[model samples]
Target chain A: MKSNTYKEYIAPVVVLVCICLVVTAALALVYGVTDPIIKKNSKATADKTRTELLKDADSFTEYKGKLVVEQPGAVYVKDVYVANNKAGFVATCVTKSFGGALTMMVGVDKEGKVTGVKVTNHADTPGLGTKDFEAGYLSQYKGIGELKATNVKDDGQIKFITGASVSGSAVHYGVYAALHQYKDMGGVK
Target chain B: MGKQSRLRILLNGLIKENPVLVLVLGTCPTLAVTTSVENGVGMGVSAMAVLVCSNIVISLLRNVIPDKVRIPCYIVVIAGFVTIVQLLLQAYVPALYASLGLFIPLIVVNCIILGRAEMFANKNTIFDSALDGIGMGLGFTFALFLMGSMRELLGNGTWLGIHVFDKFIPGMGIFNLAPGGFFSYAVIMAAVTYFAAKKGAK
Candidate 1:
């Protein structure tokens, strides 16, 4: 009678253990299969962003987490793109936002003038903050030299989109930080 | 377990026992990810797949499982299916995966999955449990889609990224913010409750 009870208890335990093992093995298999694809997709997105931000530049290099153009005597412009006769580098700034993160790729020439600013990613209030990306607003950053974070009335100012104060500040700070990085890398503005 | 009653099992999820509106289960994904129709649909479908498969498996093994260890066993089964859904989404529908983010992994903890396991799967036969799973999944999907549409329309003036009211309406971008999410959910719940009450008055 004791053996019968023991068998009854041990049988269920064995079955449960077996089930747990099988389920875990299946999960491992699925994770293994998808891991490669996820890595590839992430790389693709990064490459695309690099291409867009580095347009018109011959070659690009990553130095200290910033993409630097392979141009000679590149000057860093604060919120500006500086280009000479030959080649130039642009500063792309990224910042964390409400939803995800925001990336602004600012193209600078050898002359320390702003070529353009493109918003790469933004999860801001869809309509309001997203308007910051629209050409009408973003275009204002073009050809700007020595851009800085200040109110609209302040010097080296960029227009802030109405109802998107946080995003506006984030973009401003991103640009300023990128410019600082460029200056540290011997690019003058 | 009755063959004739299987239909009622499925129908219960759609109306009287709706997971989102009636039962108020799985509100995290329902509220957090329903900012857009595409995300809402993707999450809903993924959850449905996990729910149906897990429910069927649990029901089939119900008699074999000891009463003491039933909760842990149910969780393992549910987590197994959730992992499958998460991997599939990451591989085939990467965009959805990016949008859903951590919520995909959080599915393992979603109360709806556990609640269904305890309430229906533990007691019911496999067929009835499967039908219940499908019904509840659909109900959840319906609620998500409804909320997503409302939020997207007001926030971005679009549906599934397509401009719906470009000429006439000015999109209230605040609707896309977190506050907008809460407002939309409350309004939707109120409307659903109002209609449910009217129907019951008869």
Candidate 2:
């Protein structure tokens, strides 16, 4: 009776072990096949965004060490990326919005003008705050002449999306920071 | 299980016992991935593939697993399948994989896979369990596609990457935002529930 019980239990254990081994091998095979594709796609996405912000640049290189760019009335830069010939720089900036942290990439021309801005990530309230990033509103930054945080009435002054004050301010701060970084790099006018 | 009765069991999961709507078993993916039709379909198909494959393996091994360690053993089995699905999505369907994001990994925790493993697969014949899995998976996919279509249409004025209502409507972009998802989901859920209740009443 004891021998029979042992044999019965051992049989199931062997079967279980075999099944697990096979399943693991299969998963490993699939993972091996797909890992490279995922990595490639991620790189492509980053490159696309970088290109959109620095259209005139031939190449871009990440600036190492701590570099802060600040115009007289703008925010500070968290990091900087210099494009070819110092024509412009991309800076990372963050601000508090209604939903959560709003992060944006701000591009500034050599003359300290706002060249472009892209909201890289944000948790802002979707409909109200998110619209601030819509092409119509964001495109206004294309030729913004200079970084002036307090000149709210200037035609080139940052415009707030009526209902999304927090999100608007976040983008405003981000752009301001980028302008400051550009000037500090001696690339701003 | 009777041969004919086995078919009934399979059909029952497709509609009467749907993992998404009827059973409300996998709400996380249902809510998270249904933002667009493409994403919803991608996630649905990936999950179905994993579920069906796992169910087959689980059923075949049921007799071998000791009851005490069955739950843990089942989890390992399910996780293995989930990873395989994740990798496949990442490779061949990069766009869909990006849209699905972490949700693909979250499939490991989806109750539908584990629930079927515990309830249907463990005790059933291999063929029957496989059918049950396919049926339930299809039901979940159908639900996701319906939700995705509504959200995409209302949120972005587009469907399946095509701008269908663009010519007919101006300023129809409100639906593409986040609040639109909530409103659309509520309306669709209410409608499905009402029809389901009405059918039951008859």
Candidate 3:
């Protein structure tokens, strides 16, 4: 009975525990080596993106002001960064789309005019909803100073990609919220 | 197991017991990430790395691991290795890591890794098990590449982002969607099956 109990319970338990310990130690060792490199890569990507968006900006300073939260037309602003050279503000916004939340960055120059809009991350459906994210479709928002209404039907500022209106609206609203952030910040104060 | 030549064991995974084509393991990722050649190759290479590492470790522990808890032990080892791969990719190949996204973590549950652990690694020597992993990994990669090329070419009129027939013929947009994925998968599967049958008849 004693030997059977050991075989049935103790042996398996001890063996599993030992395997778990070794695996955990191995994971910790790899994590220690790679964690810093991962952090550095992401930071570098973010910096490069910001520079591309605001071409004249020498550097960016994260905006500490109250972030734009969920509202009627738009979702929420994820982050806002002010150009150190006073060129503009780059606002990251998350808005609802066909697939899920669509994250984008909108660059607004000092005159409250739009410089560029880029979708950074999105889960929009492939081939259908993704059509709205194409550069040609997003390029219409460039040089626009203000948005009285966010949707294409309301304002002719931005056109919707045919067969992907929901994703188009999501991209539109993302820029809407970003411009709102710029206005709220009173244009890079 | 020792009776079989090492070369045969390594090559078995290519066509005979190909994990994606013959065994039909890991169908989920096979369909989901094959929309583009880049994503397909990236996933295949990442999976191969994990498979080779896990098979060797599991074979080495086969004698010491108690039968009752072997499954759990295998999972822990596999998950650990998957996480290790994930970290390295995130660090060194951030673009691939971003494109793969959720699928990277999902590799932990991929049946091919666990299936090899249960079937080949437990019974075979470490060297042989490693060979099986390579063979199976290559088979999986080959299957994914074939599907990726077909879908990307017909669906998007491009291969690896280079436009193939955009000027003459517009891409059938449906090929990049779910229905297109299923269609391409079925066609490829049928071709592989037909070829295998002919080989067998001979």
Candidate achieving the largest lDDT: 3
> Which scores higher on lDDT, 1 or 2?
2
Q: Over the stretch A35-123, how does candidate 3's per-residue lDDT look in tens digits?
A: 99988887787778788878988889999888887574449998888998899988888898886777888888999888888887776
Docking tier of model 3: it is medium
- Pitting candidate 2 against candidate 3, the one with the higher DockQ is 3
Q: Ten-residue segment with the worst summed lDDT in candidate 3 chain A?
A: A122-131
Q: What TM-score describes the B chain of model 2?
A: 0.83
- In model 3, which runs have C-alpha deviations exceeding 4 angstroms? A71-75, A94-104, A119-141, A144-173, B1-4, B93-103
Residue range A9-77, candidate 1, lDDT tens digits = 876687678789989999899989988997787557655654565466555544444443322222222
- Per-candidate TM-scores read 0.69, 0.66, 0.86
The window of 10 residues in a row where model 1 chain B has the poorest summed lDDT is B97-106
At residue A61, what lDDT does model 1 achieve? Answer: 47
Measured against the native two-chain assembly using Cα atoms, what DockQ does each of the candidate structures obtain, in the order listed?
0.26, 0.26, 0.52
The candidate 2 chain A region of ten consecutive residues with least summed lDDT is A147-156
Docking class of 2: acceptable
